[model samples]
Target: MSSRVQVVEQPGLAPAGLDPDAAYAALAARDRRFDGRIWFGVTSTGVYCRPVCPAQTPKAQNVRFFAAPAAAVSAGFRACRRCRPDSAPGSRHWDHRGDLVGRALRLIADGAIDDGGVAGLARTLHVSERHLHRSLVAEVGAGPLQLAVSRRAQTAKLLVEQTDLSLAEIAFASGFSSVRQFNDVMRREFGIAPSGLRRTPSERIPSADPALVLRLRLRPPYDADALGAFLAARTVAGLEEHVPGRRWTHRRVVPLPTRAAVTEVTVHGDHVVVRSGADVRDTAALVRRVRRWLDLDADPATVDAALGLDPALAPLVGAHPGLRVPTTVDPWETVVRAVVGQQVSVAAAGTLLARLVAAHGTEVAGESGLRAFPRPAAIAALDPAAITGMPGSRARTLVALAAAVADGSVALGSPDLDEVEAALLAIPGAGPWTTGYVRLRALADPDAFPASDLGLRHAAGALGLPEAARALGAHVSAWSPWRSYAAQHLWTSLAPAPVKEPS
Candidate 1:
């Protein structure tokens, strides 16, 4: 069953790096490996589909390839009903690419377009609107607005299928300007009204609770237990908690743009269930944050393949196949954590952060027994002497860093990694390890490696690699572009092996 299609030069039709021949091959074979990597639109049906679409493959002449779903939509193709490409795991390409288009897409997914229009997004990226548009169109085959529209439609569709929220609430929550616009966009994108996408009662996953529960899809081989343990060890008392139960469940107060919500996340085999009490309008943003925090969009196979090449990392990769570098839901909170974590144990840092949260964190409106992490302004306004646990110099550094973020001198949301790194390094007491750790988790830099980290150095020494920071840094260069995952593997290796009971 060698399904093949003739790939012609469709100049300006496909994204820059996508090979039409390879894309068509994947599509024809219904390859699951290419699920999020590529999409195709059929001229006859005027519909786009995921690579793993179960439908019959179309003719070569009528097929067109796109790197992103937004590109297909922008080219006047509706989503395929059968495959539901909108719910596919996000492309791993975005994880490593720090290019202008990549950065723009990251911000767009985070609701930057909904919060601020195209012009504002461009300004944040330090680019002119025209330049930004041209670059995205050239590389991604769609401009910012089309991408945003596609995102909204996907969010709306997810809400329609999963939740019992009203159409009006879904519209507002998905960032549509009005209910009519939501209906119009939904119909235009999916060739169906919003209500038409809903699942029957029998098809819905059952939940006994009243909370808004949503299933987030992810690539497989996820080491949920390992990731949970990492978060559990560093859990701040009032802000986040990990329950001891049959399933690994973590509850945390997520501060969304519109409001703060308490999210209860339970990790399953292939996906994680998110239960939240936030307003419907914040669902889309909350989903994005949860995905990012859990590092769910990662293609573990790809990362494993790359890092597994090294002799030292091969055993690690074999031992823990899908370990993830746990990221932050809030960039500011991560920055605070990174600064406080410098030269201190993880437990000590968590204890100090809990105290800080108790002193300055704002209470959630409806949720009792939880508080959001203190905002930068609150920390920045503090007197240096007020921070009780840490050294006075470190206290000054935290306040300085907080003030820098509070006043917009440091843009955590910026896509430009170099600029962000420079700003962080400029803050007094923020060293390579602090900035690198922030880049690793908060900013989601895949290549971010804090070579000077004590844990990393110690792990490298134990692995028979170079023990010194400089030597270890040089040795780990072979694991470039996925050093973050490599770091996770190394850190996990440091944990004590579980004791066997007379097996």
Candidate 2:
């Protein structure tokens, strides 16, 4: 379904197109989504990015408008280290294409192009390579490979700007196939040697070779305290820690494929710092996973507006206009968290999670002292006694959950969420509420609603299930692809945060 509103080039702000003068006027608003989508290149400095670039906002005459980073690079502007305009999520224009094109963009970001060639990606998308080629060229001025190449170049830029990784490592990390290819593309894209892209040398960085660490950005009024409080409540024992002040703030390593090492994540303002313990050959791929896990790519203005139909949620909609549901950095951790939360209060589930991590998780040694979340095999290998305090029934369910995950009976990453929900039900003791929660939080499916959740149920009673489903579904269906965010608003709106009672 295409957006009723076409994304006309911001001829300024209105379709008539505003000059640099008017565009800068919008910048003073600190609109983060507009940061990269529009830019002004200073002729003097030869730099251009989103208006929100925190360095120094340039004067009107020095700026220029560009909808695409490739366009900016075409005109000669290196990406800023502080404001990585290249890393912005695909324009929401892609999202509104309720067709093969939209799904293709979503899947491409999920690493389809890097994993396989155009034919393979096209096949997964149920379209011909030729048709896929035409659609991308028609819409974005880049074919699938061109789009993927652009993404790769941006990834290279990030690694060059942030880390000490070699060009060869940076190439593969950025999803390029070879060192020469990486260097060639970087020069083509940025018109400079890859080596010249470095910003500054970090005095102290992680020992992980062939790894690149970068921060993922989001819009402001993010309700970080709410996000932290939410994580602090559900963070499992050894797998994650939100109560901080020790080593890496909120650190826990999740498993990676090549080496059985941990991946740590810490949240800064509007971004999460991912710390890799082992060298990652594909830095772009790693960053994509981190972005998906943190759910950072969501465009909030679109989401907030989509979720604002219901009057009951208007206050939450007002307080934090661009709220996002928390996301899981590791699918494995998501499964474990779901199993722990089954019949327990959020606090109880969190206690069990911490205990589980401490017992089976590996230690990440640093003053940022973190530990890797335990692996599926580790849980499968453990004694029932390790969950000593948990109910025997719950313990059995968890073991069954582990075995399912370990055996590939349930593949976790981006599972057809509905299928996963059905599979969860097939497991003994799992219910609709638990499965729904998993979809809403773990899978990041916007449409997944815990219709049976006490809060949702109460919120819906005024309408009844059929009426509620109709009313709620009708209300949030416009949120379409982002219904999970709408559900988060509905839930958070009723927040019963440990009360001193609102004065």
Please write out the lDDT profile of model 2 over residues 1-503, one tens digit for every residue. Answer: 11121222323241114455556776656565454346555555665556677777666655656645654554555555456566655444343344676667766766677778789888866779999988765544346776677787877777777777677777877777788898887876655788877766663345464334666665554555555556556666555555443222454555554443355566666666766655555465567666666566666775676566656555667876667677776766777777777666778777777777677778764444556777888887776656776777777777877888888776665325555677778878677777877877676665676665666655545433333544655655555666676567656656655322121
Per-candidate TM-scores read: 0.93, 0.72
RMSD of each: 3.6, 7.3
262-311, model 1: which lDDT tens digit per residue?
88898788888898887777878888989989998887877898998988
Clashing residue pairs, candidate 1?
Answer: 173-281
At residue 262, give the lDDT of candidate 1: 86
Candidate 1 runs further than 4 Å off: 1-9, 12-18, 205-210, 497-503
Please give the CA lDDT of all the candidate structures. Answer: 0.85, 0.63
